[model samples]
Target chain A: MRVLLVEDEVRLADNLAAALRDGPGFAVDCAADGLSGDNLAGNRCYDLIILDLMLPRLDGLSLLRRLRARGDSTPVLILTAKEGKQAIIQLLNSGADDYLAKPFDLGELIARSKALIRRGKGQSHPVLSALGLEVNTLEQTVRRNGVLVDLSPTEYRILEYLIHHPRRVFSKRDLLEHLYDYNWEHHSNVIEAHVSNLRKKLDAAVPGAEPVIETLRGRGYRMAVGPEHTIEPG
Target chain B: MNQVKRSRSIAFHLIAAVLAVELLSSLLVGILSYGYERHIHFHAFDSILHGRVDSVIGAVQDAGDVDDNVMLDTADLHVPKDDIYEVFNSRGELLGRSPNWTGTSAPPAIPPHRHATFSEIKVNGREYRLLTQQGSRIVDPGDPGGGKLRHVTVIYGAPTERLWRAIHAAVQFYAAGSILLLAVTGPLIAWLLHRGLAPLRQLATLASRVSADSWHFSPPASARTTPELAPLTTAMENVLQRLERSFTQQRTFVSDAAHELKTAVAVVKSSLQLLGLRPRTQAEYQAGLERTLADTQRLEELVAKMLTLARVEDTGAAPGLPATVDLVQSMQQAAAELETVAKLHKIKVTMESPADEPVMVALTQEDCSLLLSNLLLNALQHSPPESTVELRTALQKERNTAEFSVRDHGEGIDPADLPRVFDRFYRSDPSRTRSTGGAGLGLAICKAVAERAGGSIALASQPGQGTTVTVQLPLTPNPDAASQLA
Candidate 1:
């Protein structure tokens, strides 16, 4: 899943972004200040936005307030050094999903981000289940009926996005945004390669398997969850 | 709503006081003035009544014939409209009376040859003033023969309603006048008070704008300025100055602390990332672990110093922490404990008084140690090798004060930077502060400890010369010595 991180501290933000991007393969876009973060949030789509309170042009609290006022329901997690109860209560009342104080561990930050994204898609656990198949988010592995199946990282991420969000249409731009960070120079065509490869791998795994990740021609992609005759007895 | 309450505002108090005094004095003056005016009018009216009596008697005597017959002439004398009279003979027989009294109710017949007297009589539901003139008079004015005098009594009755009417009118006018004055003066006094206190309102407006972020404070000028508000404005300006200074220091403390914490965290994070980036040999892994341990150790020390700074700054002269301790003893103990560090650095530490005289202060023993320890540590670390750090203790007996002063000979601070040397995280050479293992919070803690003990700390230094730091605390006398003296 992709996320947006808007924090002012350069070193902390850089390391956090690197960890989210290369470590767990969460596509993260970093904005150093509030105004630019607001602009990027409004123009593009991100599954979750990590906001910091103090910023250069506009403050994070006001940005969150304005963002929610415009009816954008993207889950927001606040990062702040302001420990006052009044500030926390106000931030929460102003539509903040959760908050973490400064000097927190990067690992804890990543876990919280993933949890928010998972809950936003209405999933119950880190492992997504659908179509008699299971995708393990933590192990980056896929399995059909208790048998392990190999998949590339990119293919796993795209399927991971679709498996978590079943029966939803995602345009190529949406898939690319969900899979890649804002810092990447993305051509929407890159998502076509990953989706087709994922479709091929899912069919090849079974003797006579239907395409699971179905592309709705001229639209985008949706997880195909249709009633089948039966699973072949192996 | 009509009930009165004790007001807290100065403007309300002033206006109420002025109105109360003015209202009471106005009522008194109005009553006195009305009574005086009536008294004067009554005195003048009495004289006029007596004159009318005398004129009527003269006319009667002049109209008298050779016989004892009284002929009253009422033509020449113009009697008042409200006056009535009657003349009586010696046998108490009525001879003549005024024309106004001919048909009206006659006054009572006063006895003839009685002394002239005046009285009040009521006739036909009206009050009259009666004057009885009794004396001897000639029967005929033209007779040259000496004749015996006849005693005649003249009873004159005058209506008293006119006098009361005049008095009533005067009293009514005075009451109306007082009511008018009260109505006008009440609002006038209120307006005057509001105008008088306008300067104070301006001062409050100016003071309210003084915040931690915005520090501009200027007293009101021109129309809003007054002599009575000058001292108040000056006091507020001084308070604002103090607040601004503290707020600036707090902001600096925050930024400096945040930078220190972030740098420490970044060091450990980067070190771990570099080690975990690729596979390494067992020895290299051990070396990397040792480096990370060193960084973590520094981080722990930094956190500890920050906590010490916070505690020292937070401790007030609280009831839970009150204990009287000997200052010299604490200072000497702290010095003795730090002697190892001093020896390691080749520094000489000496105390002027070695517990010979008890110099007591108002802080606890541990607090005194903390203050002295921080100061002495700062002095020792800044001093050159083989240099001397002297500890001096003295009691200013008259002021009941105890002082602990630390003097260090080192490459002293520059003159321009001397004032900020006690600031938290202040380093003369920013690069060497961490290398020297000083978080720059030593002197700041020393200042805080001294202040929390109800004392003050001062520092003086010059470039290339020695520096002196002084902690002056209020002295508390030993109870044993005091009891013996008593």
Candidate 2:
């Protein structure tokens, strides 16, 4: 599993990178501060991101938000020496997948990483399909018209949630709760915005496919079941 | 120099000395003046006595029988209102005298050696100066009608009462003039002393203002020429200049040390980040060493906090572009951010504000934000689970102060530890544990920030009770003080 490690403390970052490299089934790269970490996460590919909250040029929360803004679906785990629960909650809400307080157990950290990677691939199930759009869990890809479509890690997660449960009417709140680790403010509107962006990408990839998401006016949004509801490029 | 050691400053001592000498000499002059006036009164009274006796003798020579025409009633003798006289015949009869004199007659015998004499006598409990003169009557020895024998007679007198009154009035006038002179010249004496020591006072005030930040202590040019005090002034100026130079050097040393330490910390942090990116050969050991990395990260945080505290404590100003912040809004924002933490801890954290309007303070928004964040964190960390932490803000109107207080329901600190809570590296619980402790720099940093904003911090706690940390800041633009006399 590939991971991006962001920390400003040089010795600790170096030592952590060395340890992650030596750990079984893990490949880790490092960035000194939040700004560099954001750049690397945006331009490159990684399975997971290890972030530190305190950095000189840019802080971890802003970096996490920027990475998410760039449409990167990498799972992010926050590392911090701060014990305040507010800091932890803020990092989670801003796009972090998990957080480990400083002086965390190494075994627990590895286990958490594996769990995050598993979740990032969308809770691998027996069979998954949404509104006639089908995804093979084993192959980690989606298909329409019997044509295979390559899906990014984040696209796979979004498609996995819709495909796992079909015609059950999932609201945006439910999707956000199940997809992200932390809660956002009700006024954030980030969930709807991200979903719209995701729908556009999915429609482009699989032409003439039914729209997966349905807006349930004033209540939330859901995945539709009708054949005529094909998603346009947006 | 030693004589003036009791005085606080040389100017004070010089003024005191001059006033003392002036007082002593003025008193001596007053007494001397009284003495001279008394002397003149006595001499003038003697001359008046001689003139009265000469007129009496001229009248007696023209009278044929001394007892008949020269009977010498004081009214008949034509003496002025202030003079009196007495006549004695050959048989020594009492003749006339002034109205206030008490005696049967002039003394019968005159002193044999002198023509005129001055004497002192007592009458009615008052001492008087008496002048006497002896004269022989010229007579024909063959004529029975003339005095055949020359009688040796006596005369006595008293100080001229009129002369005494005149002299007393003159002495009183002089005494009053002396008092007026003293009154008029007192401020003049003070002004003179002040003028004489103007350079010294200036030099003193200048010396007092010399400090580490600015160390230029040169005595005023006017002081260089003062003949009496020039040496002392020059010596003081030299000493002050030396002190200023030393202070400047010390301040420079401190600033340099802080800058170097900051650079070194940055370098270390950056270097560690670079080293962390390299590949490692030992997989099993890296797994085991992950915890050590966590500890190293904690160490870096501790170092950064310690350096910040040291720098803030050394210089009492925060290195920030400070601006006025709304204190109430900052507290509200902090609470909103920390609500999730409060929920997790099962602690109810609420902000209690006095007014809906924002309470403005002379601190930047970031500083206010940081201060509130730290205070809330401390409150949440220390308070018991499920208990409430209360944050309050108030304006202490009487003292012209603005105050912020955070109260928690935790295990309070020991009384002895309260005083040192804000000291660097001071913690109530010193056990090295991540769950319940930090590097003990939080409160120290908060204190430095408050002091930098012209404020103060105080902590009060009782065992088994709650703890309240209060920060007090002085309000600006004292309108009440300005309008007080209006």
Q: Pick by TM-score: which candidate is best?
A: 1
Screening candidate 2 with a backbone cut-off below 3 angstroms (N, C-alpha, C), the clashing residue pairs are A10-B272, A10-B273, A11-B272, A14-B276, A22-B283
lDDT of model 2, residue B323? 54
Q: List, residue by residue over A1-234, the lDDT tens digit for candidate 2.
A: 456788765555655565554442345667776677887787445668888776645778888888888888789888765555776787777888898765555555666766686677555443455555666654556776556766555455666656544445666656554444322244326667666776776677667766667777877655676665443210
lDDT at B96, model 1: 78
TM-score of each candidate structure, all chains considered together: 0.59, 0.36
lDDT of 1 by residue, B1-486 (tens): 233344467777787887788778878877886798789877777787778878887776444345666556677767876678887777777767766555325435555565667788776678888878775677654557865477777788788888888887887788788778878988898898888777777777777888777999888783225777777777777888998898888886886688567656765775577566558789977987887687778778888888988887885525473467777777778899899989999999978863456777777666678888888888888898999999999988788788889999988788777788788877665434565567678888888878877899998887778889988898775635432222
The DockQ leader among the candidates is 1
Q: Write the per-residue lDDT of candidate 2 for residues B215-254, one digit (tens) a residue.
A: 6777777777877668987787787778777676555444
What's the distance in Å from true for residue A45, model 2? 34
TM-score of chain A of each: 0.92, 0.52
For the second chain, the TM-scores of the candidates in order are 0.79, 0.47
